[model samples]
Target: MTQPSSEKINDNTSFQAFVPAVSRWLAWQCEMISEVKIGTVFLRSNTANNNLKMFASWPENVSDSIEGKLYDLAQDVIDGKNNIMPKMTCDAGQGDMVYDTTTLPLHYNNKVVGAVIFLQSVRSEDQKKAVFQLFQWGCALLESTLTDMYEEQHKFHPLVTDLAKLALQDAPVALIGHQICNLLAQQLGCKRVVLGTMQGLQVHTLALSNQLRFDTRASHISEMEAVMEEALDQDQAILYPKSEEMFSSVTQKHQTLSADNEDASLLTIPFSNAENAIGAILLLRPRNNPFTKEEVKAVQYATQLLGSSFSLKLRDEYSFLNLLVQSFKKKTQPVFGTGHL
Candidate 1:
């Protein structure tokens, strides 16, 4: 893989080490476009800072004039242009090299976070359209990958801290579950959130966000449990209105639940300990608002952070004699009968 040039504009120490990996990935992606002679990407320093800095450039070396042109095109992309096409000529060793350039903006959570510019050899109108289509596809892939990476690197710490703090609160296990459900619903923009724990082979709903009491036998409650059980049975997260990427996992229950609830989008994540899955969380939002990969990951992380803590709390809820008797029964099972001690 080619390395980016050291000459960076608006260089920030925070992104110094981070930029290279992105640069390499972008370089590789650009190389995939057979017609592209040069490619460059520019990314925002941070959400608060609108400054776009050169992140990566293919070929590792390019004339200053070519770099300047790409930078201008990238700026235009950042300014909200959907697409820009321009013709330019650069002198290669042989002679004047004519190229056609295309630029596209990259978005995360509906916000433009970066831009990519590609320079392809001049071609016919149809061929240029094909190259443009390739650029759009490349931008989509880049956005998805970048979103996951950015969340893992920058958002994980805050998510862990917030969930861990909730787990540490001096509260009952049921109340803690309620808090977690509410927190996740609020954080993930879900209209409702439900938390359920595995009891024997069945998952029991422990808490529902924004609701102090709900009928255990209610139709919606049962539907929610069914969705949770579906995910727990498979031991994997399930997203409703399922994406093509999740085709292997069955989502019938999730679909039914969503359909019954005004076609809302749904996501169920089962969290487990070392032995097996202990509980699952279900999040629901409007049908138009699907869960993003980052939000799904955040919920998965929350379950990992809180699953064992909730299990321990539930154990502590048992009477001292009950726990002691259970422990004794386990210890003496080989020597004595196993029927309720």
Candidate 2:
């Protein structure tokens, strides 16, 4: 079976796109069993909380009666009920076409999350047992898929949560930026991490991990700013020692920065708000310890949260400064005689 791609599973719509393929495979497997008439798969839709939607149905022309019955059986399985065995056969159509239904719940972390249902013609006891076993195996494959999807979606929750808590602290934006850099460096095992916020079209370095202060005009800092601008300009993540697949991304500044620093592996991810690019994060580590897809994704998520926090803090600072200016004007108006002094 072709497993769902990591990138697809991380997205709900893309994940659904692969369900039909899995259902097709399961339908083919069921066709091997002559007694099995129809196979349907139901999964909990992330878009609709707690609602189980029909992900795929084989033959594409199943009667409404059969589909409704299958949905009921699937719901039963998800509700922790006993497997609804073939207690009796019922007419699925107007004619004497009788069928028995069976459902198996798909589990992830030992909790029922979805189900697979099969409608089969009347068969002997042994035949029924074989069909049930096949359904069980199919459910196992689906369970494994669900587990992978769930893990991929949440693998960065801890990192994001930690960064969010730090960002929420009542501190200056620069101090918060420094704390974020320090946390990211420790979590991601980077030799250094730099945070920069976009000012007009240029990126100004805000904080560097493990350093209380540094000269902004330093050559190394300038190179780092250039690297961030390279990513912000392209509006995409850039990983230096660029992969063969990333030939289109302009990484000239990244290459220079990495070459100047012992050929270190460098990653720059730009974060933006609704308007435009707001900030970027640059991480550096040894060349041998290149960043992985998972690490890049985690940082991307973290940067999004950080960007919003920083924007809000900066806005607040601007508002406070305006209030202070107005207060000073009011205090000086009495002494200055309102523009005559």
Candidate 3:
């Protein structure tokens, strides 16, 4: 498959470490195309031999994964010689399927370092042009996400590593919640971080940082519960003090809490395993200690792993979870059993 072809670069990182989101981005590109999309591949050159190889492909095709010079035109584009992008249509898929493929060179420092190959059902040249444009948008997003991931890894802050270790540890959910609250409070300069778990439907305040005693029926606690539950119910991370977001029950509670606490800021991130939210974390900062966007984003990403772990333990805890629950009951008398919720 081929007739149309078309189309940056940055960074010095090896192409071997591809971004995980690129896979999703590929699938998304397949969806947005105005034609029947076949697949897309990012081809990179092997530095050792200067031979072209498939770096990654979407909708997985074994043929694309193979090491081969499919065409001289593609090789020419990769070699910084041919300026015309290659495009063609060919038979693909099992039982005689057909597809249109377009190869566009990706340049870096005026050198052709890689190429993007797009495939779909043979369509009008106009459709090919539209797809070419859409593909560019996908590439831009891919680049941004990869750069973000790279910067995050390069930073490698101690707190970030420690948070990762904490999330990955084998521990009871209650203990994990308590430790996470404490860790966030210390790392982010939060006055308090209340870890709340969605037991059945209602949210239960499982742990609070630094404090051993707090009123369960306190107005502030009620607001926290409301805000946390809202986040979990909606499965979103929210920043209080009303940014460019809508007014929900959680937002309203946050506004009330802010007024009472001298406009203290709040950041609530729901803990979900991609299926459903199991809990949430509410970070409370004093007036002068507002949470930054970077800090909020870092905590939100950290919760992705932590939330999955929590959900896994919540649903599949055989002995450890059961023992933990029993122990909690024996010790603190179960602050609101899921049954009570």
Give the Cα RMSD of candidate 3: 14.5
lDDT of 2 at 143: 59
Q: On residues 1-341, what C-alpha lDDT tens digit does candidate 3 reach at each position?
A: 12112211244335566535556656655554435345544445433234555555655664532224334545766666655434443445544545566666654333455666665667565445444544554454455444445445332345544665565456666676778889999988888899887878988887799875678788777778988887776767878865564334357766776777778888888876555677888998997777776787678767765665565555546556688877877666467664653
Per-residue lDDT of candidate 2, residues 94-186 (tens digit)? 465667777777654554556777777876654455446545544554555455554453222467657756765668889988999999899
Cα misplacement distance, residue 97 of candidate 3 (Å): 41
Name the regions of candidate 1 deviating beyond 4 angstroms.
Answer: 1-157, 319-341
TM-score of each: 0.50, 0.55, 0.51
The global C-alpha lDDT for each of the candidates, from Candidate 1 onward, is 0.73, 0.73, 0.63
Residue pairs in collision within model 3 = 1-88, 1-89, 1-90, 2-87, 2-88, 2-89, 3-87, 3-88, 4-87
Ranking by TM-score: 2, 3, 1
Predicted model with the maximum TM-score: 2
Error of model 1, residue 185, in angstroms: 1.4
Off by over 4 Å in 3: 1-153, 157-159, 212-220, 245-250, 318-341
TM-score of 1: 0.50
